[model samples]
Target: MKASEIRELKDEEIVHEVRRLRRELYTLRSQAVTEKLENPRQFGVIRKDIARLLTEQTARRNQAKTAGAAE
Candidate 1:
């Protein structure tokens, strides 16, 4: 998914997506170990997606914290 598309998702949605992606990643890794993966590059793509999601999550958390502190 594109970062812009991900950014448009709500926090809860983002969390759900992250969980789903992680599970997929695990399955992909397992496949890679047991057999040759058709698309070996998927691992890197998924990893980057996870990182992007986490980065967005962290940014939102920090923004919330700062806003709360200000209030």
Candidate 2:
């Protein structure tokens, strides 16, 4: 997933997407163990996506917290 796409997602959607990606990562790991993986690079790509989502999620949460505190 691209950073621009991630930025466009709602907060709830970000959480949902992260959960879905985690499941995919788990399955990919299982496939790798069984030597069934077609593209090993997918693992890195998914991990990066997960990180990006988490980063955005955290930033939003922090922004909200500061906004609430300032009010």
Instruction: Please name the candidate that would achieve the greatest lDDT relative to the true structure.
Output: 2
Model 1: residues with Cα > 4 Å off, grouped in runs = none
Taking all chains together, each candidate's TM-score versus the true structure is: 0.94, 0.95
Model 2's TM-score against the true structure: 0.95
What lDDT is obtained when candidate 1 is compared to the true structure? 0.94
TM-score of candidate 1 relative to the true fold: 0.94
Model 2 per-residue lDDT tens digits across residues 1-71: 89899999999999999999999999999988988789999999999999999999999999999999999
Q: Which ten residues in a row have the lowest lDDT in candidate 2?
A: 30-39
Candidate 2 wrong stretches, greater than 4 Å: none
What's the lDDT for residue 8 in model 1? 97
Q: Pick the candidate with the highest TM-score.
A: 2
